[model samples]
Target: MRELRGPIGVAIALWAVVATLFHLYTAGFGFYEPRSQRSLHLLFLLPLAFVLYPAGASSPKDRPSVLDWGLAALAVAANYYSYAQAFRINLRFENVTPLLWPEIVFGVVATLLVLEALRRAVTPVLAGLLALGILYLFATEYMPGMLNYRDMSFSEIVETMYLLNGMGMYGSITGISATMVAIFIAFGAFVTGSGTGRLFHNLGTRIAGRQSGGPGKVSVISSALFGTISGSSTANVFTTGSFTIPAMMRAGFRPHFAGGVETSSSVGGQIMPPVMGAGAFVMAEITNTPYSSIIVAALLGSLLYFFMILVSVHLEAKRLGLVGCDPSEIPPWREVLKDIHLLAPIFLLLVLLMMGRSPHFAAFWSIVAVLVVSWISPRTRLTPRKLWDVLVQAGNNMVIVALACAGASMLVACLTVTGVVISVSTLVATLADGSILIAGILLMATTLILGMGVPTTAAYIIGASIGAPILIQMGVPVLSAHLFVFYFAILADATPPVSVASYAAASIARSDPMRTGLAAFRLALAGFVVGYSYLYTPALTLQGPVLEIVGQVLVNVLGLVIIAAGLFGYLRSPLPMPLRMLLVPVGLFLTLFEAYSVWLRIPVELAVLAGLAYWPTLLSTPAPVRGETTRRAESAPD
Candidate 1:
């Protein structure tokens, strides 16, 4: 495989920087401009598309061939032309007669480009969905039942695909990407540049490395912290798991358990606060809520998730009787403090956001902070070359996100044009027959299934459009509905059958992916219950009176502990099978409904207290090991 020459690498880097700057400019500045200028934001991705082929490749086979480059260039050009034409026309046509042939041509090329880009950047499943949606667009007239749509000529279809009326590449996905999504991504990149990643890892090690399941706890804490800045679950797993997975294995965790721990914890990052997955941005757009509110809700979920992970690690440590690292090996406080300056960027970002600044402004200034902070310590200072590299890497990362956004934008566009969202929502509402819980369940199932292969942003947009309204109609709060779907969408990454994060972790641990996925599912049981709790108890969402919210939080925390203990099957010691079985359903009932009959609640509470009290006794008992039992039998027989 031939490596990229210095000049080529530099060129690719410049292209990415240019594209990102264009996106930032259009997103942050174009809001006051005419609609046409706003639409021009689509062109920002063109240079990014050009650079991505070279940037993503790492080998001769991976490198973009001449033909690949040509195709990419054509796609970008077509996308630009389509956006330009749509902006000029501005809904002037009532029918398809006034649409231009160039629009149709662009649509075809853009569709092809989106598919190829998905194949290169994401997984095959996403690519297939894009193809399927485009196919549906072309063959809508022949479909039967609820999927059927009005027949349109090829030109009409192209016109619809290229238009800017809340559908097409210029609609919700790209619109949000242009605004909040880009800013947060930039914020994350800048924080990373300022060395927040290292700080998180070091802090995680210091806080958790003295425990029995120290490494696993470290993975959970570090991954959750990393998720605050790096919203991508796959990236989170590789970054923290590379260190923690091996450590866990060395500390005596089974390969599958280690992999499952990392996978589940890494997947939690998407639901973390501040810079959650792109899905949160889309949710804000669709629901018309402040971005900060979504961040708050996600923060709540993340806290619960990380707490559960910590409990799991602690219990497992107790079960295994493992020891902590030697004190001599621990890093000194003074050394850890030396890099504390790196945290300035993140602190500034949070403060700016809390102060009501736009995410774009917050991100831009935070980048400046990162650059300045990096120079404060000579050891961590970014050379001019490294600064340029950070800019370039930021751009490269944005391209993968941009292309996925564009493809998802196309899918969303189709849903709008065909009125599929309304249709699907109507069908789901009818199925629920006015029950909010049933409607939410149906929506949850749908999002989970769709999200298995689709990116979270796309899944959230699709689910929110189709599922959220049903919940609202059934009396569920709008924020709760959208957040519920978003939570389930992220959980799909740790879900069975097609759990991408689990598969990645399994590869690293050399374990069975299915088993690892199931383990992750078990560990994440509390999250699933929390999803239902949002519907049952709005207080968990910070919506009720202050006192009520506090009380609800207390109950919810207790419920989480009960569920965790039940799932682990040990408190201070191994729980009896009957007791474990009983606690599971009791925990779910208390958590999900928040309404426990006094009879059931009192008995269950007492039983849990008794179990806790008996924990020490259980652990102290000398249960015979399998090997010990075998030796005693052999000696007796002789």
Candidate 2:
């Protein structure tokens, strides 16, 4: 990102502030017609991307170069034309009318500019996917069997991807970005500007500072809280992990383990309720489900996700004989409680969401509540300068997401026009041979592969566009299918080789990046199983009878405890290797096999695992391993 000086910097800042104000205004009042609203959104944001994100690493970092200005001018021209013609374009039957020369020229310009801006702001993966999508349009005639589709002409492709109101840069995906997601991003900026992130950290340290593995637990707690508003996992890791990872190392955690704990916790925040990053809004849009219902359904799985991480931290702490920080060094709970009013905006947002208000409506009011609550305590107040910064920062933060939505819209347009979505669904369903489990496994692998190196929102969008339909074809509920893809897309952040969040935490902890990635992947294994279980039984998502939901919750909790013990190699005491190895499969069976009576399985599984975990204490005190003394070395500075 650049740091321009003189009039250029001021002008860029004003553009960003205006973009933010546009979303805020529409959110509180009413939105314009769809194309008008979405086009105006792109008009504001795409040009900002051209100025802010350099074309390459060698590109000018301090100011816009000639090419940057030219690109910005082109972006402005294209999006402005789209905005001016939005109403007239919407009235015409798309692809039926021959394109006017000006529409063709601007359409082509808008498409290329959006793709180039996406490549600059985000990774090139989505752009690469768009390239492949267009290639597929031409290649469809040559595809064999279920992969085949009718060939589309080049002009039709451009019209569908650009001029069509529901398909391309102006599609529903961009619509979500322009409205609901944009409002929430602003809400996050306001919340952070009000010092809520600091409040969460102090509150977490106060509440969990005295527990076993307290520093590690604090990471899990604080990251989860901060992750709510800071929707990006990498951002969450850098913000919370900067403090938590070092604290964990100081409290006797190995550097890699500390990185792993922070990575897993931060990723979980993307799946956390109320504001689950940008993906949840896209999921709500794709599934045509209410945003409130999506969050409610996701609540149990998210709670269980945190439960697994905490249990892993506790067990690992116990195994390593780690203790809490000195009480004198920790803040008293009373001091932390004074800033609790900072959380009121989040609570108000949740209440409004539950009351069935539109997401943009809820977010706008929450932002107002943040400004009001910030003033109640001067320490956390947002001044005029801070408010301006928040507005600019919100626009800056929104660039990647808004462009991502626009980019993914082009890809979805390709798949929809070519009929590849349905074809791929049929192919996967056939490959599964009528087994939902096989279908799920295939799609999960696909989602993980697609999610690697991609942001959660884009990953989920691509995964859902291709993967969700496959599961739905095999009888999975719409909500269940999209969420299944959603979970794995998030899990990809900690998966090795391309674990973006883990590598981020590793940089902070000064650990080997790959080792930290592996540790995070291991810590987050429960999330994978949870995704699978939900696919088989919707009860895990609170979609079944009351008793079934209650029973599944209890059963799953017991199952996770067993799995955590096995993974961390501890429970009541050091577990024998065979017993620890055996616990994992048994726990998985209990969690994954939902056909048995939940009432019957809960007690049986709990007893079996509890006895196994506790048996070592009954036997006798186990001898300490060699080098135990050396393993607990004090943390080293980066």
Candidate 3:
């Protein structure tokens, strides 16, 4: 094992160097031919998958035995043969002839390789799911319900898998991954290497480190910034929670509360703008919307999510009598500025994106900017060795995502081949009976359920393919349909029973996993409002008139504050039960729907304000017995 390690590492290192150059030229400068670019993308995966083999196999039980290696080798050979056949067919323009022997051979091998790689990289559950999908595809004639289809010949299946058809792995999934997604992953690596992550953490700490429940609030803010860029809930939790959770504990928060706060905040990252995981890029490609618009919508959701967290933290602080960190302990402003240059890449990327450039170009240049800027400051300089390490690390990181994309592509291919997406869409529309509200709820549930175990990008892609069509057909705008599915897909990270983000936090805090998951759900209630609001208030989506948008934004923000206060059970002090319960429903109504009549909403709005104002006063005034005691004490003062 040790002898093979050196050669494998060297080979992986060489792949990184070549892939980096390829990405820079193709993604950065946009100079590669289409076929050449696709070939490079496929070749880049070989060394990456090999290098990750060891790390992904930590336990003896996980070690790939001789049989496993043989199967893997056979699979790779099959995949290559398939690609070669597909390339030939592309060259010939022969109307997808199923008599293609090379195509059949390639399909069989490629399927085996993907299934084995999935087993080695992800989980058996995913592998099982893929196997079931393939089996069902082959046995379509025997299946019942919407799943039944005419039995495809072996050549027909091979043609679907290998040819330049939409069902093949080289379609949209890999298309998006090789272009936009890969560039952004590189962009994130560049930014993290440049120390922008630390800058965000420091800024969050400086702004929110010295108030009641300050540490918890800081966690919310810092995790949001980190997650927005990193776009993985588990990564977000580990990155920001390491500091924020400890700080929250020191500031008198229970372990469970601290963990829940970090978990809930971190999960919001996949829905945050700019670098929002690989899903945002896929969202743009699938919906035909500008990447900038998706980023804006995600940013709105992120802002509302973090605001809810802040309000909850503030109320918790008041209830618990927690104090902020000492002023002397806060980092100096000038010191923070020393690392401010780290932010240049992100700002530059955003500006370029807003100016209508491709995300690939934006990410490529942003990476260049980070490397160049880091060289200017000795404190952030990346030496040749470090640069190589970064490349290797980036390549390694791309493997799981790349494989998942490949697997998801199969699912997409199957859906397209069977026309299952249209079938499912029609089924959902029928079930909802054309009610947008009912359709939205059912779609949301489907997204969250499917997304629980899958990566956010894969889940979002699948959800958008199956669910978005239904919503769009129901007269929902394109952006709203996509965004709605995307939001619920992200919510799966924090959703109960299988909340991966909450589990990460639970491990860190040594708290009960289920309890932390429940707490996270409570902390993230406002996200539900934001998700539903996208359906009702198109203005919040920047789709309507400016005045109407402003009004929607104002009402949404106000409603969020009220809901946060109610959920946390405190405004100025412990809210009386009656007012807390009253505010919860009122806030939900105003936040979820802008269609409420003025006459109906005005009365509820007035009642909410009255409750907010009177609750504190009612709590502050002394009882008659307490007043009598105070008078007696004054008369008998020493």
Candidate 4:
């Protein structure tokens, strides 16, 4: 986060460019051995973390201190030790071979360095988790029954956490970060730098600016589009919410409501298809499912999430008598389409992915495609300077992801080595009393709590490590279980109390963080419903027949619409409080109604909901809005 202006800054910049090029080249061609590949990646990123992120509040802002340089050097040395010893490390059986003093020393340093880097670049919550995992490993033998395992010595723990290739700081999770995650992050950087971000905003305004709840809808559309590449919900909020939140306030929306809309919609982007959040890649790696298939299964559930957000916004706008942007202020469709070529890379990336190409391979070509398409218009072109900026951006972004993954690897190492993962899974299974729903509720709570502190990807990794096993043991499909964990992890960003995305939006909107967070949680409630829905019927994940998928999807959509109407107190017209209260549970019950064929349930549920919605109009005349927001908006136009 420092802004150095001298030779040290230039040196760091050069290192970042080289780091990005390394990943791009490896992605396009082939990777090195797993140990070599992952360790080398840490070598490139770990040093940057120390230099870029200050160690503490008193740390220098303009340049790294001597201690920073020393730490960076240590990171490089420790990772180089791994790179050099990778062959021997690979050949040696984990926990079976005795470690030399030097290996033990370097392993300890590497593990500590990863934890420190993660603390600097990410949340200390995750770092604390990793530290506790290490302590738990040391205290294993003293723990109670079912929580007990053979205690590991310092040297043995070092071997597991660092020297080993597949279960620690240099594990499969880190491998995911170094390879597929890094390449996609680089692709995102290029896409962002290529003027496509501007295109997304413009396209959003063009398409949604004149609709009901136009400004909020614009936030939903732009954030979701940007989320595909950006992946981070808080990043998406800062990127798109800066524009849309102010627009909503100008259009007479309450500050908290505006922030809530942006927060919920931005978080929904992680569940969006194609280039989903980094957690999706981790899910693929952990579940051993194809990335394409995961996205495919996630498609409907993600749509329902956005649909609820959109519907809620619409109903809220209607209830407030909110008006869209003036037609003159909206862009013409043709003008917005002029930069449509910017999307070619994403389309091509999708094509290659559907063709069964490796994710890194697809992302590598997609980066190339971004370069090719960038030259189409002078306004969007990436010159050498811009190219360097792209690389710098990518390297900087990868720091958090790479370190988070390495830290997560360390935690997973402890859990596995201590046999805590299975114990926790068994405990949840027993507590659930063989009920999948109860087991899911337990996992969802854990993921949401964990996600509130760490990045969603790391949360998913940890949640899946603990929760997915329980669901799978209960006979849930592998993909369904992982998706369930993934959804809650993402939704945590919009959940109240500790919602990061909502807080980010609140900063922009100058709203109460708690109020904005509650609003966001309310708007995004459908995501939770979708997660639970898939637990019962994998068809919601597109696992069943086409007709079944369509019918169930229709049913879910209708139910969500009803829920939105009830929550917002509007359906065709504002409902009386009693009707609003009645509609919510009625809607929920209908959503859970799945005994008969979905084909048969759809029309009946539709008729019943329609009767409830219109019944309010028949009971009494609707009241008119006379609020200050409406009066102020009419008196002083934007």
**lDDT by residue for model 4 (1-638), tens:** 88867888888999999999999999988999999999899999999999999999999999998998999999999999889988888889777899988898888888888888888989899999999988888889999988799757888888888887778988999999999999999999999999887889889888888987788888888888999888889889998888889999988789999999999988988899889999999999888899999889999998898989989988999999998877876888787877899999999999999999999999999999999988988888999999999999899999999988888888888888788888898889899999987898899999999999999988999999999988887888999899999999999999978998998999999999999999999999999889988777889888878888888889889988888888899878777788778777877777865666777767867897777667856677667566966887789957
Q: Which residue pairs collide in model 4, if any? A: none
Model 1 superposed RMSD (Cα): 5.1
lDDT of 2 by residue, 1-638 (tens): 89887899989999999999999999999999999899899989999988998999899999988998998898888888888887788888876888888888888888888878878888788788887887887788898876578777777777877888887889999999999999999999899888898889888888888999999999999999888888888989998899899999999999999999999999999889989889999988888888999989899999999999999999999999998877975788787877899989999999999999989999999999999999998888899999999999999988999998888888888887777777777778888998888988888888888778667887888789887877787788889998899999999999988888988999999999999999999889878988997788788778979988888788889989988888888887888789889989988888888678778778878788768766856677776788765565545344
RMSD of 3: 3.8
Q: Assess the local accuracy of residue 614 in candidate 1 as a C-alpha lDDT between 0 and 100.
A: 86
Q: 1 or 2, which is superior by TM-score?
A: 2
Better of 2 and 3 by lDDT: 2
Using TM-score as the measure, which candidate wins? 4
What TM-score against the true fold does each predicted structure earn? 0.90, 0.95, 0.91, 0.95
**Candidate 1, 498-531: lDDT as tens digits:** 8889999998899999999988887777678768
Q: Residue 306 in candidate 2 has what lDDT?
A: 90
On the 0 to 100 scale, the lDDT of residue 460 in model 1 is: 79
Q: Provide the overall lDDT of each model, using Cα atoms, as 2-decimal numbers.
A: 0.74, 0.88, 0.75, 0.89
- Give stretches of model 1 more than 4 Å off: 1-5, 24-59, 82-87, 94-97, 597-609, 615-638
Query: Which one is best on lDDT?
Result: 4
Which portions of model 4 show Cα errors greater than 4 Å?
Answer: 621-638
